[model samples]
Target: MAFWRSTSLFSSSTPSTTTINDNTINQETIERLCDRLQLATRIEDRRDALRDLKGYSKKCKLEVGTKSMILLADILQGDRTDLDLIQLALETLSNIMTYEVDNNDEQPNLPQDITIQFTELFIKNKEHVHAALDLIEETDFNIRRTSIKFLTILLTNCTKTLQDIILESGPMGVSKLVDLLQDEREVIRNDALLLLQILTRSNANIQKIVAFENGFERLFEILISEGGSDGGVIVEDCLSVLLNLLKNNPSNQSYFRESSFIRRLVDCFALNSIGEKHWLKQKETNINLFLQVIRILVSPTNSNQNIVACQRSISQCGKKKIES
Candidate 1:
């Protein structure tokens, strides 16, 4: 099946074309469109220009085509202004983002504005956020993984917006994002971890959002689960985020400390004895992460018995390493 079809970007039936008379277009109009397309800076202006460019493309006007080509060349130049142009370009490109153009297809040369537009939209909009999420659900695992990576870049640029969208999507989006921690794509997993990191920055209400959906247990399972070789980087990131959340919520800390979750986290670094040999190659990284967890667990600000238990776990792990 076609990728776009899976994403539902196009209709099942072929779209009918409405022809425009080329002779009605002139040089001046093309130059004006070019100028409007070039001057687009903010989200609104870029969106307008993209709509106009689509119309121009549909009209088959040579002058409009020339203007679009010039704009696309300027965009692909990798100018410092590329970020500003991403949203506009993305909106226009959404017209084509999921489609595979033929080798000899007469594809319009997208401007810097258009390229930036897509990048920006990917960074800003909640709808685009959902699209990125759905991409993770694709039948092709690579596409699912790539979607997460793309989301990471977007989250880096639009932290507030990313948080807002995640919050708005509520438990469902949170669950999907957490599930991605076990995905085959390392980058996607890393992005999901980063996203959780950002979300934890919100007040207790947002941190509580995780518990509303049983996210804590799901996260623990990922850390302790066996099939996470591709997710080591992400696992480390997830641990960092989890530590932050646990530190912030006294109730959560007390609950996990009593339930064996804390011990299980330390056991995650327990050499080949943990039952997963594939993790050996990543032992050093995992050990460093283990140390970080122990430091957080033993911090003076934490409760007494929990700190002692964490210290014991750390010492045991070190002794086991020495014995080996």
Candidate 2:
């Protein structure tokens, strides 16, 4: 949050441009971390370097983080077989990506050379970046979890530069994240759902990914999944994502219908509607989210059968809620 740049960096005509000046405090920390990381011959040494690298990333802030990140990227680009090292590197990347989006320390009137080149290197070269992207598929839960967490943070907080870089990276980046819904871990699946929600909320060139052949099916699986207990994270996140995907997107709406998501929804509601009227009381928030999804799916042009099915679900919900 401290400012080291001079007053002249702020030109009246250039309000949008900001730059990261080379400061001794930030630069020194970055240099030390880089040296430790490069000279890491022992497992403990690498771990310490990764640990300090993460700390320096934060301490250096925007521009300093950029320089530290360039070195960080170089370390990761090497063939890193050590799982802990990989996790640490991925986490550091996540922190760096996050720093790119923080505006609190931004000096808007300055030149933006360091930050610009910093971002350009990561985006322009796809091969160097794939090492982090490949970690999403690791069977190791911790690595996969870190990768997923990193990705969701990137998509949610980063500006268009990162988004464009991701989308432009083609199937390796965004597509890989989308494919995690089928992951065995419920936590990972929900994390993927969170990512989809961000993409939906942002509407950043996500039409193709949403309309993928199995995308609807995967989301539908989450909708009816009984994986989690009454917290209803699966149901809550799926509805948010489905609503976002279907809103103002007629093609996806049609796809939703074609994919039998409505039928599955009705079945899920009915499945949850049995025995006592008190059953629905515990899942009030979930039912509301489900109902909201139904609201989004219903259109004036829908066929009568679809309407009847929807109404049946709504009526079933209502009946289930009434005290017997």
Tens digits of per-residue lDDT, candidate 2, 141-197, equal: 988888777656655554455566666677556667778888988888888888777
RMSD of each: 14.2, 7.1
Error of 2 at 81 (Å): 2.5
| CA deviation > 4 Å runs, candidate 1 | 1-125, 182-191, 194-207, 211-235, 271-285, 303-324
Top candidate when judged by TM-score against the true structure? 2
lDDT of 1 by residue, 50-139 (tens): 566655443332334334643543442333243434433433333322222453332333332432334453444456566555555654
Worst 10 residues of 1 by lDDT: 1-10
